[model samples]
Target: MKGTAILFQADQSVTFIEDIEHSVYEEIKSQCGCEHCNCKIENKIVDFGTVSPVFWHEDEIDWDYGY
Candidate 1:
């Protein structure tokens, strides 16, 4: 219900072929839309890579898709 919105894009084919299919993110939060989101990012980190490690709060990510 609350978290961050990391905006980025990537080239899947290139990344996959080059075996460079991973990044190092020093920051991450929830994935839900910013709904009254009180996200408090004290010191957001932007590391190398094309937005590889976009983590979430819980151990597992929650993609609430309308399936």
Candidate 2:
């Protein structure tokens, strides 16, 4: 069965959580600043019979600067 998920970031950490509730895609699209911000939430496709959901960063992280 298809459901909804929420991918949000906070406290310098990113999280992807799955739920049957509302979709957070618009919320993330509206709040995402890519290179400058991290507090956002998005909807991801989840399939229980196939593969699990994974988190992906929009930009590459610079380990040296830790941004």
Candidate 3:
């Protein structure tokens, strides 16, 4: 399970959103502790919206092994 996290800046407040499949919304919501699943905009309609791309990688690594 790997994805990206995006942050949006608005006039009043800042919002965080992610670009991923709808099926994974639950997992992302839980992790981000976001009140809503989708991005909230005050006015105007946006096509791609104000989403900054973030790269995420999930892999199993041995932490016990010293660097």
Candidate 4:
């Protein structure tokens, strides 16, 4: 089965939490992984109380476990 894919490009100049979170989230979810399945963005949230936002793709995550 085809899995979801994620793509991200960080804007180092961005300082606002909302902008950063939304920018990163949008970039990741916008990734077109497979043409076989109809894709959708599952969840996107920003928690200021935590260090960073949690990220995951619908498919098996490779490269880094906690990037």
- C-alpha TM-scores of all predictions: 0.18, 0.27, 0.20, 0.20
Candidate 3: TM-score? 0.20
In terms of lDDT, the poorest run of 10 residues in model 4 is 11-20
Residue 50, model 1: Cα distance from true site in angstroms: 4.5
Span of 10 residues, lowest total lDDT, candidate 3: 46-55
The whole-model lDDT of each prediction reads 0.28, 0.36, 0.36, 0.33
Q: Which stretches of candidate 1 lie over 4 Å from their true place?
A: 1-3, 11-41, 48-62
Task: Write model 2 residue lDDT over 1-67, tens digit each, in one string.
Answer: 2233334443344444443323243433444544333223334442222112223443234449853
Which candidate has the highest TM-score of all?
2
Q: Distance (Å) between predicted and true CA of 50, model 4?
A: 26
lDDT of 4 by residue, 1-67 (tens): 3343333223222112221334454443444232221222336443222112234444444547664
Predicted candidate 3 versus true structure: per-residue lDDT over 1-67, tens digit per residue: 5333343323233433334443343433343433333432334332332233222323333448862
Query: Which candidate, 3 or 4, has the higher lDDT?
Result: 3
In model 4, the runs with Cα more than 4 Å from the true position are: 1-20, 34-67
RMSD of each: 12.7, 13.4, 11.3, 12.5
Model 1 lDDT at residue 17: 14
Provide the clashing-pair count of each candidate structure.
0, 0, 0, 0
Clashing pairs in 2: none
